[model samples]
Structures are given as structure tokens and as C-alpha cells.
Target: MTRTLLLFATILTSTQAQQGFGPLDPTPPAAPIPQILTHMAQQESAFANARDHYTFRQDVTFETLAPDTNQPDGAYHQLTDISFDDAGRRQEHVVFAPANTLQRVTLTEADLDDVAHRLPFILTTPELPDYTLTYLGRQRVDQLDTYVFDCTPREILKDHRSLQVEDHRYFQGRIWLSQQDHQIVLIHGQAVPQDTRPGHENLSPPFTTYYQQIDGKYWFPIYTRADGTLHFPAHADALSQTVHVRTTVRYTDYKRFHATVTLHYGTEVPTTPNPPQP
Candidate 1:
């Protein structure tokens, strides 16, 4: 009998109330829901574009825990710098990567992709139509007031072609938007459409991502954490097994990239503006 362990992604709830904030207020927002959603979509779209101009470092850690003792049995760690070249082309440089030692589960390409992209979980104007966002209420997160909304995919395509391509996964969960800026401040959810086909079970755990304001303009993902168990069902000649997984990703050292160009003609001098000091 052969068993395979696959790890994926998701989000979890936060203990906001216990953190000294008031409970979620169920009263309707003063502004129209449609208006609020529109504003959020626009703001998020701008933020997404702005993020591409910034360089940052990402550190990821994944661990598999022993079932009985809840102690780490195996782990994986990597540190990567995401930046741009002189030509302004994006580049990824691995600064540190330790050998993976996890025996219970294996990280799939989808899993790595999720850690790089989906874990940050941005919902811009173009992605708005793919999801149904429901206004939950208003809530205060520390010093900031936020609008709470439940988010779910409108549909998960289950056709044979789409399934084979593995392209229908979507984020399903809740988000907190800053009331003043209409920008996403936090996200709690998981990727959807987990493949449970016999002989091929892929499960994801819930996660939570917190954001911090960057340049006092856009909110950016700063930390993400997921801790849960995946139950792989029994298949032909294989027995069911549960694997506990924990993952944390940190995005830091954000520095915006500014390109400078200078051109001079015959007997002409061009003055290039000084680049901003780091």
C-alpha cells in the first residue's frame, strides 16, 4: 500500500475581540453596499499595481507535526528576495534554502504557487465578478475601523477539462477593509475546490494573512500563518491518514524601485535627478 501526502493553503479566524477590540457590529454600513464594494475593488486594484513596483523579501517555513505529541517531526524553510533588475524586469533570488526534511507530506507546485501568490490573496476590480462578497458588518481592529465582508467563489468549474488543468481553485473566506481607505487590511480563508478524487487526494488548511500599510498608502500583506490537519481518505490498497501541517510566510524589507534614465545630445548636458536614498 502506498500513501501520498499533499499540502495546500487556507485561512483561519482571528481573536480580534480578545485582542481588545469590540465585537463586530451587525448594523448596516452608512454607505450603500454596492458603492463600498466598488470603492474597495478600485482601491485594491491600485494597490495591486503599486505592489509590483516595490521590492521585498519573502521567508517561508513549513512543518509537519507528530500526531501524538504535536512536536515538529520535519520542516522546510526558504528565504527569497523578490526584486527588479536594471531593466526593470522582475527577478527572484533565493537567499537561503535549507533542505526539506518533511516525510509525511510533500509540497506540490500548486502549494508553492499558493505560497507565492494566493497566500497574499488580493481581490481587485477584475476579480470582483468571480466572487460574491457579502457585507457582514463593521468592526474595529485595534486603532482602525474596518468593514467586514464574507467572500466566496461564485462557482467552481468541475468540467473534465478544467479539472485536468487544475485552474478552478478560488479563495473562500472573510476580509477586513479599512473604512477610511477601503483597502484590505486582513484576510482569513482557504483556497477552494480541493481535489478529492480517489487515488489523488489534495487538501488545504485554513490560514490568516495580516496586512500593514505601506508608504501610508497601500495595505500590503506582511504575515501569513496556517495550521491544520489534512485527512487523506482511503484509496485502493491504501489506508486513510491524517497529517498535521503548519506554515508561516513573512513579507518584509519592502523598497520601491525607481528607474532613472539620462540622455544627452551633441554639446548638451542632461541632469539626472538624484535617486532616493535607501
Candidate 2:
């Protein structure tokens, strides 16, 4: 009996060694290039044109890397409720701005528009003609394996396809698309050079956005963070200060206009919407 027990223990140890005593993971397969790009373009357009189909709250926080500031020094938050305005045109309201750090920055309306929408990096159908992409490899984003690619715009021309920042400003970036669903899971990089543009020279900053699978169908940009240095104009007789800046945007309180059911305990249960309406 003792000899048999010893042999069993040795076999178990050898089996564990063979398994490497780590997470058992299968290698991700290569993505089908054309299929992913085509399907991704369609989904992006679907999400883009779904402006009125969904409404959620956005909270943005920023901190200037001043000598004494470490946490959030300022914040610009708002609830984007979709509804027909008095003029019968659909509009979203900036229902909240807890702290006026965004005002302190004094960004122009166009600049705010770019930040609120474009910074999140949505590659819609109209924007596809503007970029050229190269498959890099496969990368694991959290538990999801993603196909990596290096994307660059063909050019920044007026009336031509580009990111459409400012009038003719164009941005270049890399994108990580999910292998299973062909959704853009991550985006990294910033606007091309802007030094010659004069007033808008330092507006662009490097950032990364992580997309979360929402409603089991769409990959929504649930969180985005940008950290970089900026030189904004100073008050009279004062020189512009070069300060480190970090901006984080979070999306929550999702409300979808549909009913859904999920299987639970061998029975179907209604999945509640994201949260209670404010």
C-alpha cells in the first residue's frame, strides 16, 4: 500500500509539472482581416447613428499636475439625455458640471465638441476611407484576445477623409480589435503635428480608451483616460505654464429601450436595465 501511494504521488507531481502550474489558456488564432474590418465598420456605424437610441451619464475628472495637487483638482460632469428640443431637433444637455475645471481650461465650443465625441475614438463608416491599417499581431486585453493593428490616416486634407479635428487637423492612432466579435477594443495615440497651427498647437494629447461590451452586442466606450503635458496661454504679463494634465471620462447609467431575458437556475429571468433613472 505504501509503495502504491508513493507512485500515485509521483504521477500527480509529474502531471502538475507537465501542466506548468499556471493558467491553462489556448493560443488565440489569427483574425480574418477583411471580415473583421468589414464587420467592424458596420458595427461602428450602427453605434454612431444610435445617438437617440441610448442615453447615459458621463463624468469627467481632471487634475493639473501642480506642485501640491495629487487627486482630482477639477471635474466636468454631465448627463446626456436624448430628447426632442423645443425646436423639434434632437439635442443632449450638459445637465451637470459639478466642478468648473473644464471652464477653467476655457476650451472653445469646437474644442469641447472634439473632446466630448472624437476623443473617444469612434471609427465610423464615413471615416474608414481615411485610414490605412496594418495587422500587427494578437494581444490579450484582459481576458479577451484581440487582433492588433497599426492604423495611420492617408492625409489631413480639407474636404477629404480624416478624423475631422478642428478644420483640417488629422490624427493617427493604433487600434486593438477583438478577435471574436471584431470590435475595436482599444485605441492609442494622438493628433498628428499641430505646432504650425498656432493657437491650437498644444491642444492634442496622447490618450487611451478601453471599450466594454455593453448589452452583449455593442462595444461601448465606458472609460477613457488622457494624460499628457500642455502649455496653455497664461494671464497678462505671465508666461504660459507647462503642466502635466490627466483627464478621465466614465460612462454609466445606461438605459436601453428593449426587454431582455437571461437563463438562470434552469429558468428565465428578466435582466434589469442598467440603473434607476435620475
Candidate 3:
């Protein structure tokens, strides 16, 4: 009996050595690119659908000119408030400076959607004109694997064509999105005038938005900055008139209710209705 037991113990030791003393793990490798993209799109869609849309308050600060030199020692302030329904309809109000007087114009849903969709670098695609979106690999932001999308616009969007132009024609910028949450960590775009001269130039606006996830399915912009410059003509009469205008907006003091974070801009939305309400 003793001899048999010793033989069994030796056999067990040999088997353990051969098997590396552990059970084999058959887990597969990570999913491929297509799978990842599909997962992201699904998450985005779900988040979009489940989001609570509300009106946002906006404060705009424009660097003002000194009537003589147009230098920006002072700034003009404007305020706007906008809310959107689930159907994507928007109601916006605007307020003017100094007295915080309310403006008469109210924005419709179509107008709101137009502004949101047309906002540069907000929605990036391969089709925007002169604009290119390149995947610049990935990095970790806020403990999430983020894919970076870089962009550049084709030209300054001054004409009405810019309104109708596809996303392919818009300004170029960089967008960093979290893979796991599909949250936008940052989005920035800059547009520059191509036809303008070197010294006397019109610089396109730079837009930057920083987003944070509130609900599991939704992300909101916590901060937004829009900056641009206008160049006056160098000839006589225009030389003395130099105006550098800058409009900046900050989305802060967020109050999260359900899936929506009620936002307040620097200013109030103008409240003008079509055809002038008597």
C-alpha cells in the first residue's frame, strides 16, 4: 500500500508540472475596429435618445473698440437662453447689454437645429469641404481610452454657402472622445480666411467645447470658447478703423435634473417673435 501511494504522488507532481499548475484560460483577444465603431455608434445613439434636452443660458463677451483705435480695452456683453424639446425644436431668447434688456427675436426649432448642426467641429465627418478628419490614434483621458479626431476647415465660412455646405466644407479641429462612455472630452476648431493678405487678415473663429458625462447616457458641454478676428482694409479711411472682436462663452454652474443639466450662458436670449408681436 505504501509503495502504491508513493507512485500516485509522483504521478500527480508530474501532471502538475506539465500543466503549469493552473487551468488554461481560453479568453479571446479584444474585438476589432469594426466592432468598436459599431459599439460606439450604438452607445452614442442610445445616449442621444435617452438624453434630457433643455434650454441653455449663454453669456457672450465681445471685445469692444474705443471708437477711435478699435482696441479692445472694453467688452460688450450679450445673453441668450435656449431650450430644446425631444423633437429637437428650440426656443431661444436674447438679451442685450448694459441694462440686460431682452431682445424680441425667439429662435425656432429649425433655426436651433441649424445652429447646433452647423456649429463647426461639433459634428465631424469625412464629407466636410476642404476639411479633413484624420484619426490620430488613441490616448487615455479621464481614465478612458479616447480616440482623437483631427480636423481643418477648407475656408472661412462667410457666405451663405457655408450654411448649406456639407460638414466636409466646415472648419477643421480636434475632437477627443472616450471609447467606453462615448463622451466628448474636448472639441476645437479654427477657421482662417484663405483670400486675405498676411498683415491685414481675417482670422476664422476658434471654437472649443469641453464636455462631461452627467448621466450614464448623456454628455454636456461644461465650457465653450468661440474666438475670431476681423481685418479692416489697409487703404485710406479703413486704416484708422481697426476692430478686433472676440466672443467668448462659458457654460458653467450646471444644475443636473434627470438626464439634463440646465445651463446658463453669460447673457439672456433675445425674445423677438416673427412679425413683431404687438
- What lDDT would each prediction earn against the true structure? 0.84, 0.65, 0.50
lDDT of each residue in 1-278, candidate 2, tens digit only: 99999999999876665532234234444546766787888888887655346666776666565546655555555555443333335466777656456433544454455456656677777888777777777766556667777777677433243333455444467888878878787888775534433345446567788788777878887887888877766655556656667767787776665334544696666777899779
Quote each prediction's TM-score.
0.82, 0.67, 0.53
Candidate closest to the true structure, highest lDDT: 1
- Residue 40 of model 2: what lDDT? 80
| Tens digit per residue, CA lDDT, model 1, 182-274 | 889999988776767876877778999999997889999999999999999898879999999999999999999877676567865657999
**How much does candidate 3 score in TM-score?**
0.53
- Clash pairs, candidate 1, are 10-190, 10-206, 10-207, 11-189, 11-206, 11-207, 12-207
Task: Give the poorly placed runs of model 1, Cα more than 4 Å off.
Answer: 1-21, 84-90, 157-165, 260-278
lDDT of 3 by residue, 1-278 (tens): 99999999999876665532133222321445445444545655554444335445666554544445756666556576655565656555675456422121122243223234433123312233345445566654444556765655544424533443223234456777676654456777653322244334433346676677665456666566665554445664345334444545654444433454467799897777689567
Superposition TM-score, candidate 1 onto the true structure = 0.82
Error of 3 at 61 (Å): 2.0
The ten-residue window of minimal lDDT in model 2 covers 19-28
Off by over 4 Å in 3: 1-52, 64-72, 95-121, 124-132, 141-144, 152-171, 191-203, 227-237, 240-245, 252-278
| Candidate numbers, best TM-score first, in rank order | 1, 2, 3
- Model 2 misplaced stretches (Cα beyond 4 Å): 1-32, 68-79, 82-90, 99-104, 156-165, 168-171, 191-202, 232-240, 258-278
Candidate 1 local lDDT, residue 88: 43
